[model samples]
Target: MIRSYRLLSLLVLALFALEPLQAQLMNKGTIKFEVTDVQTNNPDMQQMIGSMKGMAQTLQFDGAQQQMTVDMMGGLMRINTFWTGANSTVETYMDMMGQKIKTIMSNEDVEKMRKESEAMIKSEDIKYDKSVTKKILGKDCYKAYYETDANGQKFSMEMYVTEDIKVPNSFLQNLNQIELKGTPLMWIMDAGMMKMTFMATDISKDLGSDFFKKPEGAYQEMSMEQLKQMGMGGQIGF
Candidate 1:
């Protein structure tokens, strides 16, 4: 009886310890963000890219999987991108007008795409300064500065990332080949033609059960090459 009681007490204590760890885990949640500003160096494109401001983007993650959603045209068009760290695969689904298209990228495909993007970046090194910190959504975020060289033209950019929220990888960073750590809360990029800024607005742990559900209805799945061949290469985010 005494041995069993001791074992039960240890088990209870272990459970109590796990509660704190679980509370600290911000893995399963959504970080809501809005495109605060879009500046264009070109006077002609100012009216065009300016419309991009006030757009919404959400980052949802659970375990090793993260999904990003971009809503445009008041939901007339939507882009859903999923990254599975377990297999290093990326899947993108686009719903625009009446078209339902999807693209699945394997680990090799993602690596190839990342390499192509990394080539545009002159250096693979990133400078993350922990001393420069700020709070976003009440979470502390550190500063990271990096530059990219595209066709001999260089553009400087920086990101604010917080370790308080854990994610397998940052999707925007993956796409642009920015090697910043933790979850990015603020991203300021200068694309030469335009300067776009994205900042997190809300953080929530209430993703609910339908968070992982894929879009309903038929989706024509195609490879990356097929998508490019369709004259939609630059339109979609790989």
Candidate 2:
């Protein structure tokens, strides 16, 4: 009887461990969003457009936990973003002008970015306002208004989340068709007076540790102004 009880307990524990692993395997896939410039007037704005052809991205999620790693690039810009959870932490590394800059952020940075995006969407202060629900690309979304104090800039923004569509391989697939609900993985805003959209794409289940590795070439870091003078600052705009 003792041996039988011990075996039963072990089986239960194994099953418990397998549950999360199964969920992760089921959720493992790729997502992609296309980034495009819809508004173009200022030369600086035109130069910052993600891609007339649209940008592509890939992300991987670990089902056992609310963690994900994203790989994205547009033209000369590249970035790797990691998120532990919705309100936990986010880290990003941006490659610009042959140099990489890393940003380790807390929930505060995420909230700040959220507020700024909300302001751009509403052309007003979003701090005290509640977000409204809407539909984008056939997926339910939440939206809010926001405005910028810098140069008195104004923008319209929209955010979306979805969970319906599932793919087998997220790294190679395009995310334009995935049906998801209540996922805060998309952001649309105006940068330098240009309307731009960022879509999550090419999600993966197995992201190697090296996916976040820095480049191998030797690089000379430069300040924003110096990079601009060298015509390499545009890489930082996306």
Candidate 3:
């Protein structure tokens, strides 16, 4: 009886040890990332990059609702989009110059953006180096290498991603155009004079429904065309 009791206790401890691992592999949660660095070739852009340093962004996934939200710029800008079913509204909220602005993109607008992005991805040389793996934010991630040539400017990129925590692949299209088996945990992009890196700082299951809802208050609404003319359409992930 003593030996049986000891074996039972060990079994319980082993199961408890696997609990966190199971949670980490679960497909539902919110992941927080920080912009550790940003580099650019344009001197003017470099000056603006300082405001983005140490900036934090949160990507929340609601498996039940099949929706996701990317909150960046210290919550001053948020892009909300859906992954499953038909959601005609892709909403973004931005706080600019003490004014709250809400930008709405229709399903047609999002589809157009997707095609343009797909073309851009096709133009790049992207590959995965699975042999390289690192533990980032306590989760294992693999490396991906790629190069981008935009407007006659070429740059190289290295990204770390993990397949353990699953989320809709479409959710990452705005930041990354390549098709990946995992979610990016860290990235280092080099464009001669410009460089930028994003690192995941936290991953948790504490996401709430409220995180996906629009902010409470008056907001000036703008259509996709107006935002594009203002050179701000991309800010909303369009």
TM-scores across all candidates? 0.79, 0.46, 0.74
Local error of candidate 2 at 148, Å? 7.9
Scored by lDDT, model 2 comes in at 0.39
On residues 15-113, what C-alpha lDDT tens digit does candidate 1 reach at each position?
Answer: 100000111348888888888988877876655564467767787877767777777557755677777777877677777656777877788876776
What TM-score number comes out for model 1?
A: 0.79
What clash count goes with each model? 0, 34, 3
Q: Which is the better candidate, 2 or 3, if ranked by TM-score?
A: 3
Question: lDDT for every model?
Answer: 0.64, 0.39, 0.56
Q: What are the candidates' C-alpha RMSDs? A: 15.4, 16.9, 15.3
Ten residues in sequence with the least summed lDDT for candidate 2: 14-23
Against the true structure, candidate 1 has what lDDT? Answer: 0.64
lDDT of 3 at 223: 73
- The positional error of residue 217 in candidate 3, measured at the CA in angstroms, is 1.6
Residue-level lDDT for 67 in candidate 1: 73
Candidate structures ordered by lDDT, highest first:
1, 3, 2
